[model samples]
Target: MSAHDFNPLLDIPVFPASGFAPLADRLKRIFATGNDLLFIQAEALLALEAAASSLGRPGLVAVNVVTSPYGTYFGAWLRRAGADVVDVVAPSGQPVATEAVAQAIEMLGHVDLVAIVHAEAANGALNPLEEVAALARAAGALLVVDAVASAGGHAVDIEGLGIDIAVLGPQKALGGPVGLSLVTVSDRAWAAMQSVPRFSPSLLSLLDIKEAWLDRGRGALPGTPPPLEFHALAAAVDRLEAEGLAARITRHQRAAKASRAGLRALGVEPWVADDDRASALVTAAPVPDGVDASALIDAAAAFGVALGRGFGDIEHRLVRLDHTGGRAAFGPVLANVTAYGAALAALGQVVDIGAGAAAVTAVYGEA
Candidate 1:
């Protein structure tokens, strides 16, 4: 079946009230098998709060801010916690280099923590996590990764990669509800939190949640949780594991290849030129000359394919084609490509629809 052929409902199974036990059991097993860490929200603000309290020396904390658009918020939070922030700025269109991160740590002289976003879906960039992790470890800095866009969409071995804390949300590649997030905290991270001063909102406190889960058990909690979203995330995790993470990554890679090929055939080029630096989840392309991206978005929606708009500073000149979620299916992909080609045509720009479809068909056929 094509990627778009599966029923959305088939992607997540409903768990009855009595089924919570088995579901929780499954989560426990999954965590234990992987890195034996606690799950938390994808928001780095929350993770930093927990990390600050866990590390004790808030003054010694140094955040390695990269090219992520969300770095704006993360930087604010780090400074609020009294961290000495260092912005290792990469160009908006590309990933930050590990050498830059290492240099930042060296300049700081006493680095306590290093935070990096794996894939900034907001801007269509994928950072090199393995290289960053090595630099952080060599510099004796605790590593925290925001893998919200990269988690299931690409390969990430939290423990093997030497990441102290890795955060993920279910919304992007997992094809689940958004509110539920996961954080894999290594023993090193747990120890850091153990030493930190405790100061945070009750609901946002990682210590409180970690203690409850590690001490009492998985089902135990300080207050009511987002049970439905958690259940949905668990179902998403199951689907990912069953399908095989490697295979899922390969599928996304193929889809991205097909999409880029189609766009090229239509005489449009990606905003981010380096193929290796671009993310598989989303591609940012310049709006064809004489075509208004906003108008194209409206026209594509008429065809039932929703494309993400360029965010932040890149808003007007670019349009983001998101291949994440259930829409990664072949049919949805073709629909999006065809609709986009047609939208460009409506704007008086010439495009070869046959060639675009054929490019996608070629990739899908090979897989």
Candidate 2:
């Protein structure tokens, strides 16, 4: 490869400012939202921070749902911006009860913003978004969601759910690049952002993202567009559509069900007790007696069993087995169960690896 040679593999086409809105249109289809969408140059974390920070000026009261560490991050950002944040904290790895969220909303008097994570992929805790969204609707609060881990694998209809601002990352189950954050902003959210003077133009400004794109004919992108990542995003969207989102979601659900059943055969149980309440993309569990989750994670790695670190406070206490995006298949489900059983055995815990694998196979076969 000569220095002057334009390697198509390494050198991608420059993503034009005009190309952004069209790509965002495709991304909006992921959540089935008619709201205005913005492609953030950074990860969903930064996109969320920008939205929450700008929405959290003085006199703002927010009812923040705390089911995972992501929620904690949002609450902190809102507080820093002088918002009185009411955190409805649920136990780590467990779904947030809808009742608690309603109670929080009632107690808050007037909530200006409502923030929640749709799913905690780190520890497999899924929140009750529909009910919470209803509460936010009744309160007339701007609802913000970090749907990074759930958008692809889970059913997310931002319009139907009345989400004011939804931050999504396709890297999780959408199999897209990790560098971009696809954000859908509602008219209500834009109005709220406009009221804050501190919401000025910057990398951490959601208004800047909207204005940069919509203010002047699909306005200029803030920095040099990340061409490769944009290409990766497009490719991922194409692949997902080819497979069909319904089929993709079904695959993750089957993988999760298989993982839970197989783990039971191995004398292990799910971290979140209710199967329906947990995330379909990840199967998290407590490390059995005589074994540490961190140690098991490392041991599993030796056999190429890559897993997600537990989210929030359960990082060291729990373990996550992923069945997301490209890995949400029968083959990956079987491999995950076998590796988990093998790791348990290595930790001096007697588990039926064969039986566990068979269970996984049976579950996937049923699906």
Candidate 3:
């Protein structure tokens, strides 16, 4: 294909800022939320930081559940904002227990906010968001969840879960650009943010976006919106609507199940053994004894299959077999499982590659 023939692909169109509010409305429907939603032209982490900065202030006590690095960052942002944060940290590759969250809330007596990450994609842990949300609501605390990796892969009902502030990045499961993100805010959260007089109006200020864009009729966005990111987001929503959100979620679940089953057959246990606690986006397993994670990943790459490295403290200890976005399909799942087995064998570890492939095939066949 010559550049002349592909000119249409390169020719980009302008994404009008006026269309931002409507897109937000469409996203609200996707999330099934009646609460106010905002589209920030940045990754979900920045939006999450904004939430912590906006909600965290002097006199606000928060119970931050640390399941992954994102949760740790939330606590730091809250502390920087002057809030007294009690971090409930879970063991690596495990979800925070609901009982622990309850205990923290009870001990605090008055928690103004609760923060958590719904899914840590690379860590293989899916937090008990429903139970934790209930705890936060019972404590009369605003709950903020980083659902960047879980939104499309799993069922995320913002209003149903009573998530006071939920942040999402479309780059992961939604297969969209990483430059744009969205957040859902409840009435109570808005009120609490309004009460925080210490928060100044800035790009990361949720209140600033509300006062300037939403309150002012939701016309043009506050800053210059990136055209490519907005257009890609629109395309992603189109694809999502066409393929039913429930179906997309089911595909991810199947991918996870298939990966786990295949890995188990090859004697590689899942990082999180419980299916209920593991993330659907990726399946994580510890690197074999004396096996270098980077070398295994490189070997898998040689076989034309991409494997991800774990993040944070578990970076060198674990390897992630991604089944996210476009890869949540039979072909990719099978390739990932078989390639991983092959890489282990190449590294002198005994593995049943044929058994692993058969296991993956059986999963799809049953489906």
Local distance difference test, per candidate?
0.71, 0.84, 0.90
- lDDT: worst 10-residue window of model 1: 27-36
Q: Which candidate tops lDDT? A: 3
Off by over 4 Å in 3: 1-11
lDDT per residue for candidate 3 within 55-76, as digits (tens), equals 8888899999998888899999
- Candidate 1 C-alpha lDDT tens digits along 268-335: 77677777877888877677767777898897788887877876766777777788877676887787
TM-score of each model, paired residue for residue: 0.86, 0.95, 0.96
Instruction: Give the range of the ten consecutive residues with the poorest summed lDDT in model 2.
Output: 193-202
Clashing pairs in 3: none
Q: Which residue runs does candidate 2 get wrong by more than 4 Å?
A: 1-10
For candidate 3, give the lDDT of residue 194: 78
Please, what are the lDDT tens digits per residue for candidate 2 over residues 1-367?
A: 7798988877777876677767777777755788988888888889889888768888899999888778888999989988899999997678899999999888878888889888788788888899889999999888898889987788887898898888889899899999988888888888888777654547887787667667766756777878999889999988988888888888788888899999988888788989878898788978776678788987888888886678667877778888888888888888888888888788898889888988988887775
